[model samples]
Every structure is written in structure tokens, then in C-alpha cells.
Target chain A: MPPADHSYLTKKVISIGIVSELTGLSERQIRYYEERKLIFPDRTGKGTRKYSFTDVETLVHIANQMEEGVQTTELRRELKRQKSQEEVKRNMLRGQINAQFHKRH
Target chain B: MPPADHSYLTKKVISIGIVSELTGLSERQIRYYEERKLIFPDRTGKGTRKYSFTDVETLVHIANQMEEGVQTTELRRELKRQKSQEEVKRNMLRGQINAQFHKRH
Candidate 1:
């Protein structure tokens, strides 16, 4: 089994202002994405939103893709679909690997 | 630079039934994609939709990606985005390559 990596989970969160600065996405756009459930940033005790470096990176990629003539609606679906597809593929592969190990025993 | 390949455009056209058989996507679904302007097939004299080999391949790819957990909306956007992105990238590259060739003269 591959070693678990949760380093991203521990990354610091940035205020909405900082996130917008880093991603070049407007605060309104960020909030809209959150409302659409495109991203789920961390929350502070005072109920402020915080974004990680990965989130910023994802936003950048998303923005770049949008600029490449991809419709925003379609892009959202593609991102969601790719994520789910990989999860299914991974599970199936892991199951096959486990089955092979079991047969070897 | 890659040579232009328009061979797929000349491939045979299949009726809705054949497309469903080849792609495992329902005739309704195939027709629906066309309605959504996702895939544009040819038209018979009787106004029936005629799908080429490339159209069939595209439908299959779209279906497979949908099965992979991508939202249809996002997938469509992604596909469109990727296509346009590549076109832009190609043009940029071609321009640069042409600039270099001109400098040689």
C-alpha cells in the first residue's frame, strides 16, 4: 500500500482577500464557486473562509482552462467527472491488487 | 507540425440504430447529444441524422467519460475547452515556428 499523504490537509488557510490575490479570481467568483460547491475552503472559528495553496493552484488551472475556450459549465462537469472516474479506477485497481495478493497466499 | 487528417470526415455514416449498437449509447442519447449541439452529424436527404466513424468514436469517449463520474455539463465544457485550448496552442506554436523560419531567410 502506498504511504498515506495528508500534508495538504494541514496547509494554512488564506483569507478571501489573499485567495483572490493569489488566484486572480475575484472575491465574487470565489464565493460563487463555493455556492455552486465547486470548492470547499476551510473555515476559521469566526466563520471566515480560508484557502490552501492547492486550492489556489486549482483555481489557477481552472482559470487558465476557461481562457482556453472552455465553457464554464462544461469545465465544472469535466473536473467533477475526472475526479470521480479516477476514484472508481483506483478502487477497482486496488481491489484487483488485493485479490491477487490473496490468491498468492 | 502534424499533417492534416480529414479522413475521419469521409468515413461511412451509420443510422441511429447502428450508432447505438456500436457505442452502447442509446439512440435517444445520441440524438440528444446532437440536440445539445454536442455532436454534429450529417443529414440524409430525408433529414435523418447520419453519423460518421469519428462521431461514433466521440460519442463513445463522451459516454465513457460520463461513466467515470464526470458531470455531463462539466465534461462537455472540458471537451470544448480542451479542443479550443489545443487549437490556440497549435496556432501559437505554428506562429513561433514560422517566425523562426522567417528569421532564417
Candidate 2:
């Protein structure tokens, strides 16, 4: 099983302003990407966007990809594929753990 | 002077349905692109979108760019740049024509 400390699955904790600076992309660009359903950021009670380390990484990656002329649709598909692959891995680990428990009994 | 028959600047005339099929993109995606101001199609009195050959080419170009990981913001910037360039060319042509008229007189 992957460590619980895996950064990508962690919750949002960084502000959008900081995210913009970190990603070196304009805030408008970030918001537009969100509007396009490219990236999902957590919102505060007051409707502020909170990002995570993973989100930062993802944004940077997206920026690089865009510079390379990649399209958003393909990026979205790649992200979905990564998420499903992670889910599969998690399920496989759980099945292995369950099998070990049954053997001990 | 360049021919005025440039396809890029032509008025919209193709239906959204035909544009979708020709571009191999879903109708929703084409609409979403419009919503994002990525592509503009002319509307009919019945609120139908009509695209021109340029719009079709732009959509296909966008799809290719997205596949290459390009962001919409970048694409928007590119489109804007192209427009300004054409505007500059038009102004230059008009200036040259005025100069010729004055010299002939």
C-alpha cells in the first residue's frame, strides 16, 4: 500500500494567490482553468479558493504542458486515468490485506 | 495587398451541427469552447450558431493544441495576437493607397 503521506491525495490548504505565484500563472488563467473544469480547488465558506501541494504541482505541470502545446481535453483525460489507476491500486492493496487476515484465521 | 478572400476573416455560415461533425468534437465541447470565448460563431434569429470555414479550422487547431497540453489562456492570447496583426496590415494597406492617391494628384 502507498503511504498515507502521499501528497497528491491530500486536502486543499493553500490560497489561490499563493498558488498563482507558485505556478507562475496569472490568477485569471487559474480561474479560467477551474471554469473549464481542468482543476478543482476547495472553496472556503466565504468562497475563497484553497489549493493543495498537489494542486500546485498539477498547475505547474499544466503550465508546462500548455507551453508544449497540449490541449485541456487531453490533460483532463490524463488526470482521470491517473485517478482511476490510483483507485485500482488502493483496492488491490485492500484485497491483499483482507486475504492475509483470512489466512491468519 | 493580400486578397480579401482570406478564410479566417469570413463571416460565420456553417451550422453548429455540421461544425461538430467536421471537427470530430462533441456538440457540448464546441459549445463549451464558445462559452469560454475560445471560438465565436454567428447566431441566427432563432439563436442558432453558424460557423465559417475559419471557425472549423480553429476548432480543429484548438483540439490539436489541447492534445499537446496547451492552455486556453494561451490560445486566447494567440488569437488576440493574430487579430492585432491583421488589423495592422489593413491599416498599412490603407495608408499606402492614400499615399499613392496623393502622389498621383
Candidate 3:
């Protein structure tokens, strides 16, 4: 991938204020989420926190989950679970594709 | 996202050999795809190319498209188009969510 394509969603271009406006979360709440390691934002040269579009989406998702009474710890665990599940699924698919390719050869 | 979680799909863990095995593409073919910028792999400290599972999947997808007579240039364009469309969709969703939140406030 080109540098631009690679950074498409991960680029830290949006400021915290913009992210707060986008997600409807206060700067404090956003920082709280970062403290919990729920969203990872990049620091600018002056140490300003800058977020990506992915981070904004995650913040919105986190807020929605919190509004539904889910605990931060539980949400963290759930995210880990989901990520691992995806990893497993991808591995299985890779295995299947490899198997089919070998059989065909 | 936690550091580990953020690097889950982006980490360069699998060697090129493993990636070739998983994707059923020869090392040469995999390198060819890389030449086309269809996938990006990271270099190890020893200068060995290391791929993530995401890169493996992308290689498989690219191989399938090639088998279907898709040109690399065309595939690149399609990927760019898809990414931009996804960006637009995400922005629209964010806007809707923001509007809803403000309305509720």
C-alpha cells in the first residue's frame, strides 16, 4: 500500500475538539477513553492529541455502549474478545484457502 | 485502542514464506503483488519482509482477481474507489449520529 492509503483511516489529522464535536463526547470523556486504552490517538509535535476517523468511530461506539450500562472493563474485554475472534476466523479462512489450493495442485 | 489491539492486524509477524503458504501464492507472485502496491509488508531488523494476516488475505484476494482477468491497475483503482466510498459512508454515519445526539440533548 502507498503511504497515503496506509494512513487513510489511521492518520492523526483531527484535533481533540473536532473529535469531541464529531462523537458528541466531551474532551474529558475522550481523554478518559484514551486513559482506559479504548482509543489510541497520536500526539502532535506540541503534544496535542490528534485522532483519526477510526478513533472517532470507536469513541462513538464506546459512548453508546456506556449509555447502555456497559462497564468500561467489560467493554475492553469485549473488544479483545471480538479481535481474537476475528483473528481466529481469518486463520481458519486462510487454512481453508491453503487446503483448497494444495488439493487443486 | 490498546497497543496490542491496535497492532493486531497491522503487525508484521508472518514471514514471506508463511504468507506464500497461507495465500497459495509463490514468493515471486507475492513480490509481484507487492510491486503493484496491492499489499504492504514490513521489513524485519534483518531486512526480511514480514507480512501480517491482513496482507495474506489481500494477496489471496489479489490472486483471485488476477485469475478473473483483472488488471493490477484496475484492481488498484477499485481499491481506492472502495476506500473513498467507505470514507464517505463513515462520514455520513458520523453526521447522523452527531445529529441524533444533539437532538436528544
The best candidate in terms of lDDT = 3
Q: Is candidate 1 or candidate 2 better by lDDT?
A: 2
Q: What TM-score should be assigned to candidate 2?
A: 0.45
Candidate 3 per-residue lDDT over residues A21-87, each given as its tens digit: 6688999999998888788887756787867667778889999999999988988898899999988
Deviation in angstroms for B44 in model 3? 43
lDDT of each: 0.73, 0.78, 0.79
- CAPRI grade, predicted model 2: incorrect
lDDT of 2 at B74: 88
C-alpha positional error of residue A105 in candidate 2 after TM-score superposition, expressed in Å: 1.4
Residue pairs that clash (backbone atoms under 3 angstroms), model 1: A70-B81, A74-B74, A74-B77, A77-B74, A77-B75, A78-B74, A78-B75, A81-B69, A81-B70
The model with the greatest DockQ is: 3
Per-residue C-alpha lDDT of model 2 across residues A5-105, encoded as one tens digit per residue? 43323445456655676689999989988886788887766787867666777899999998999998888889889999989998999999999999999
User: i-RMS, every candidate?
Assistant: 23.4, 20.6, 13.3
Tell me the tens digit of each residue's lDDT in model 2 across B45-103.
Answer: 77877676668889999999999999888888898999999999989999999999999
lDDT of 3 by residue, B1-105 (tens): 244635536655556765765678899998887898778787756787867656777888899999999999999998889999988998999999999999999
lDDT of 2: 0.78
TM-score of chain B of each: 0.74, 0.83, 0.78
Per model, the share of native interface contacts recovered reads 0.00, 0.00, 0.00
